[model samples]
Target: MKKGFIFDLDGVITDTAKYHYLAWKDLASSIGIEIDLVFNEQLKGISRMDSLERILVHGGKEQAFTLAEKEALAHQKNTHYVELLQALTPADLLPGVKAFLDEARKNAIPCAIASASKNAPFILDKLEVTDYFNVIVDPATLKKGKPDPEIFLKAAELLGISAKEAIGFEDAQAGLDGIKAANMFAVGVFSGEELHGADLLVERLDELDVLDLIRR
Candidate 1:
């Protein structure tokens, strides 16, 4: 039986990917890095620092950045992202996300959020979905990001559940990898190709029957 649910915050819980893409595009343009949305996809479920490094490397100009220069540019991008997120409203939430959380809670299944964003708590609070989770494993508490499994594992630990009993819901490929690494069942949302490590894939959150999914 399922005991817990670990959710990814960005594309899975809130529609923040567009804002992140815009911020990264702004930063890339400022630094002459020439990053596009395709390149930005590589940064999903990754830390801002790691994302910047990968963006620079992919753009074939990583060596051009000094530590200080990288920090300044990444900070600038964060400023843009935070400003954009300030306009976040409840309507920005993904379809069926709220209902899923509500149903999970009603069913007595524990729910938690595991996100690479250091701003995870802030975004959750803004969306007013924080109360739906019993615990949240965010960037602030973890040294490693997704694909490492530490974040998802920590969420399971916090919810007092075994990894096998926790289902991880994620939108990014990295997050799927993390769930696999943690020995949990992964339910991939949004994209099909990104569900490489997931046990199942759904185009929309509400499309999946939670009880039926857990059975498989």
Candidate 2:
């Protein structure tokens, strides 16, 4: 069977989650909305607008922002995130990820990024690994977010492979849900949490043979 690989960006590719946390933290504070890492957990694998809405709910400020104000606030957080991402380097590729990308190339499997983050392209460019992906899903073009199958389905479409022939790797519950919903095999990269729904779960990418994830 032909196979393709799809990856989620933030936690799966690099550690930009810290930058995401810090940026969101700054945004919340600027608005008098106190937030902590625990609250930030809700933002994972979700779109920026959805994440901002979640933060608003946590701060009890959801009703305070008008549609225009909400958009402006989300833009503010994104600007902060882009600033934080400026420091990324090739070393920022998660341990073993580059090797796996190389392995995919060696084995002739197509790869794509299926992430909820709008800054995915910027980060990939900063890391100098933009060439690895056959397609990078543009979050701005999507009407739905993770836990919805749209992102992975779109990725598989771009790869010209059926969802059943693609393997997706993710580090969050919502991502796993979306991968499975798309009828693709799912692998969860453990990031300290007990992610329960993947077809296969491993602590890191190096633990699994790339060929196994790719075919059979």
Candidate 3:
């Protein structure tokens, strides 16, 4: 059977989640909404806009802004995120992650990025690993987010592989849920017991035998 690998972006690829947290924190503070660690946990694996909306609504401030106003706020948060990500490069690739990607390519095992991030492609370009993934399933191509399976399932479709033939590399419970919903095995990286459903979990990105798993 043909095999492929899929990955999430934020926590999986670069450490952009810190920047995301910062941006959201700033936005929440400006709106007099506290984005505590508890709120941050709820925002995991969810879209930026969705997270902001949730914060606003849950804080009883959603009605304060018009739709266009809310969009502007989301855009401003994205600008902050982009600014923080300006220093990202291939050198920032996680320890041994690039080596694993290279091995997968050398073994003819296809790969894709199944990210909820709309900026997945841009981030990959900045990291110079855009060529590593044969396909990238981003928010622009899907209506549903993590835990829905649409994104992962679409990635498999684009990679021409079945869900069972793909390994979904995730860093959060939502991503793991999406992978399992698509009927594929999940590889959790550094997440807590929330990722208990993962078929295989690793403490770091460098701990996997990419070629062995794909070929076997």
Candidate 4:
């Protein structure tokens, strides 16, 4: 039986979250709302529009901006994010991710990306890892966000595997929730702290026992 591994993009495959944070921070600053990393954590695994809404709530500008204005802000933030992403290179991949991809390829293990970022494709291309995926579950097509099973389930289906036979790696609570809610085994990837709710938690991707999962 072949097993599948689905991964979240931002912090799991690479550290583009910094670019996202910088972009969002710039957007907030434009609106005279100062945001810090501590508050930015709340935007993880969220949609672009949702992030703007959260920023408004945090800035007490929720009633100040109309829905259309908020949409424009989201667009402006994405523009900044795209500008930051232009500086990305293959060297920007978080440690061990390329090696992990190589190992999966050598073992003939299928992999797919299940990221909430609409820029997932762009980043994968920018980082030069687009060919590694069997299929990427596009977040734009989904009506629901992470912590919902839709994305992971779609990834599993695209990979031609059962959710039960899949293993998902995530760096956020919402991603973990989504993976488990899909009935797939979850591996929580973290840094400096162990995330609670996964079947296993590891600080880095290389620590994953891919061969063990294959042989089991």
Output the number of the lDDT-best candidate.
2
Q: Could you tell me the lDDT of residue 2 within candidate 3?
A: 37
Model 4 Cα shift for residue 103 (angstroms):
1.2
Q: Which residue pairs of candidate 3 clash? A: none
**Residue 78 shift from truth in candidate 2, angstroms:** 0.8
Give candidate 4's TM-score. 0.95
Ordered by TM-score, highest first, the candidates read 2, 4, 1, 3
- Backbone clashes in candidate 3 total 0
- Tens-digit lDDT string for candidate 3 (1-216): 439999998777766777788988998888898777667877878887788889898788988998899999999898998898888888877676888888888888888988877888889999999999999876876888888999999999999988888888888898898999999978888744366698887876668887657654
Off by over 4 Å in 2: none
The alpha-carbon deviation from the true structure for residue 179 of candidate 2, after best TM-score superposition, in angstroms, is 0.5
Q: How many Å off is the CA of 57 in candidate 4?
A: 0.7
Error of 1 at 184 (Å): 0.2
Provide the lDDT at 59 for model 4.
95
**Candidate 4 residue lDDT tens string, 1-216:** 448889999889888888999999999999999999989888887788888889899999989987788888899999989999999999989898998899898888899999889899999998999999998988888989988999999999999989998889899898899998998888888853347789888878888667876654
Question: Model 3, residue 133: displacement in angstroms?
Answer: 0.7
Local accuracy of candidate 2 as per-residue lDDT tens digits, 1-216: 648999999788898989989999999999999889887788889998899999999889989989999999999998988988889999998998888888888898999999998788889999999998999999778889999999999999999999998999999899999999999889899886679779888876778787766656
lDDT of 4 at 160: 90
Candidate 1, residues 52-140, lDDT tens digits: the string is: 99988877888997999999988999999999999988887889888787778777888888988878888888898888889877576
Q: For each candidate, what is the lDDT?
A: 0.85, 0.89, 0.83, 0.88
Model 4: worst 10 consecutive residues (lDDT sum): 191-200
Candidate 3 TM-score, true structure as reference: 0.93
**Candidate 1: lDDT over CA atoms?**
0.85
Q: What would the TM-score be for candidate 1 when compared with the true structure?
A: 0.93
